[model samples]
Target: MSRTVTLALVDSAGTPLGALPSFGVPEPWWQEVGSIVDGARRRYGVEVSVLRLLTADRAAPPGGCVSYLAEVGAPPRVPLAPVTVDLAPQPRRAPWAQPGGPARSLAWAKRELDRLGRPVTGVNQQRSWNLSAIWRLDGPQGSAWLKQVPAFFRHEAAVLRWLATATPDLAPTLLAADDTGRILLDHIPGDDRYAADQAERAAIAADQHTVQRRAIGDADALVAAGVPDLRGPTLARWIRDRLAGHDTSVVADLLADLDARMDRVRACGLPDTLVHGDLHPGNVRGDGRSRTIIDWGDAFVGHPAFDILELTEGLDEIDTAPLVAAWAARWRAERPDSDPERAVDLLRPVAALRLAAVYAMFLANIEPSEHPYHRDDVPACLERAAGLA
Candidate 1:
């Protein structure tokens, strides 16, 4: 009835690890499946661990199931076969079809932590394009968050490191990083600003403005870190490409309308700068003293209004007027001769279209079987675009 995400583990020699010996659903299922890698290491001195999910199925056996393809150190002498898990796992779309996709992720986590001499007390798993396994340390060191990213997101760790150096406390301290898109950080405390008070909301806007200012000085570095320079026209093209996959007349009409605005939507004379791609309250956290922005996966160089518009859309009941006015004033102070209201008015339709197109991109990247959770998001974004238009 419910949906699930699953992963399969294979050793370096290309032998399957077989099914996990768990029966009850989701909770214990994940625990027992994790044990398979543990058992291999303890029993056979094998160093197998990393795993990431690949495909999802709404009608796969007992319930909606998603499967992960994993990799191990070497082939085991024991017999190997496919694993059929009948447990509910957290829902996610499979990003890659290649062997050892999400499967190898866990192993990497264990290896990295061991290298840092930080024995993990617990681990939390999340996935979008790749894996984010939050490691709760056993003692002393407390905790840290590690994110493994896709090629497009490879610069996140670098960006964090650069920001940590340039704007102390603005971003989480990047403890260490690798060239392959893996970054470790000291976790910052405090609930996200998603349901924050008015003052806290204002602080987030101010902090983000500061970040944008600093970002201007670090423009070349941001690009080197892998953040793309996306403008209205670039954004429009991407949106059009994504919408083209769908054949609905409404979808078609939406694209046509977007194309008409393409000329104006193209990059204008306004100075493009560092824009937090997903800057809702949820990504901005902490108290007024130290507002921390998390998740730089979508940071890019674009119109400043892109970030402003995103923040505006997420201010659910926190009185956006003052926040907008204050944030706008700061923006104008940063760029004299620019009007926030006028910028937002012009950016609104384009931003909405960009978001709608992004949802479509998410849909295209994921397995069709994983559509249940993601399908509605596309239309919702499209509707927002229509409303803005």
Candidate 2:
């Protein structure tokens, strides 16, 4: 029999505020989603609302994705407070489930805010696995972004904090960070742009390359100081293992070729430096007027060439040749002694590995057919990665 799932909002008193239309799904999956929503509500108390109920057969409505309203049965006089929450599927399940428990990472963020002496005005949980939260805090004189980082994201927070210190103008000013991995940063507002004029794009790329070099230097120092390398063989092995589960015979062969190529590229020993582990266009903001790179969670110690490859990997329709050529010219201009050809060669496989990793990740987290990569325009990305490999 076909399974059905119910979506409902309950008040503080556990009374049903509203019942959404039931959706059909496989029995097991339906039960799983229901349990998750119920658990979130019970744990968060009356402040929580069940915004959506996704089913196997139908896509979630855009408007109903997350509920901002407080639970129905709260104090009658309490102003109707609105909050935004994003609920995406977890990348992978946590080893332990603590329903109604304080998010382990949030504790760190709260502590860091207290250390900075900032009052949090708003907090929103992202729909990611690592217990990430975006918070707006009343800064000494203005507002700032307070991000809570779980153990999985410590590396990213460290890299960003370091960058902010090293290049104050290029990066957001770091207000505070703590052992728990929460980071308080100056808030910068701008829209993310993928397509920009050649000059603007080139400028952003050059700035990114500069930031990457600094990151690499910091990583080397950290390694020397006995900080464990977070992007070492362990991560690569994990990627390989996950890829092995896929049934893409054609894609698998392509990925294997790409892996061998990356190995050779790595052996060549191009300049090793800190790299923005994920340098897609989406991570960039501002038009020619202003620009900033946001989201440093994937920064890691790696070859600069590989980092460039990852940056250009996502633009399938737009010819990357010009952008690449521009990057090479800028690199040579900055470091007269650098070998442009060698750098290009090294970045090729790095780009391929990044593509493979992102594709695998999206597939695992989102359904295959519904993934953005499955769209027609994205085939160019896969093909481009193959060409680079």
lDDT of 2 by residue, 299-343 (tens): 656556655666665556366677777777766676676665665
Looking at model 1, residue 291 earns an lDDT score of 79
Query: What does candidate 1's lDDT look like per residue over 100-139, in tens digits?
Result: 5434554565566777787667664333333233333333
Whose TM-score is greatest here? 1
Hey, what RMSD does candidate 1 come out at?
A: 6.4
- What are the runs in model 2 whose C-alpha is more than 4 Å off? 1-7, 10-111, 121-131, 138-140, 149-151, 178-181, 222-238, 252-260, 266-269, 286-290, 314-319, 333-339, 342-350, 358-388
- Which stretches of candidate 1 lie above 4 Å from their native place? 1-139, 247-270, 287-289, 314-318, 367-373
Local distance difference test, candidate 1: 0.61
TM-scores for all candidates: the values are 0.71, 0.64
Model 1 reaches what TM-score against the true structure? 0.71
Local distance difference test values of all predictions, in order:
0.61, 0.51
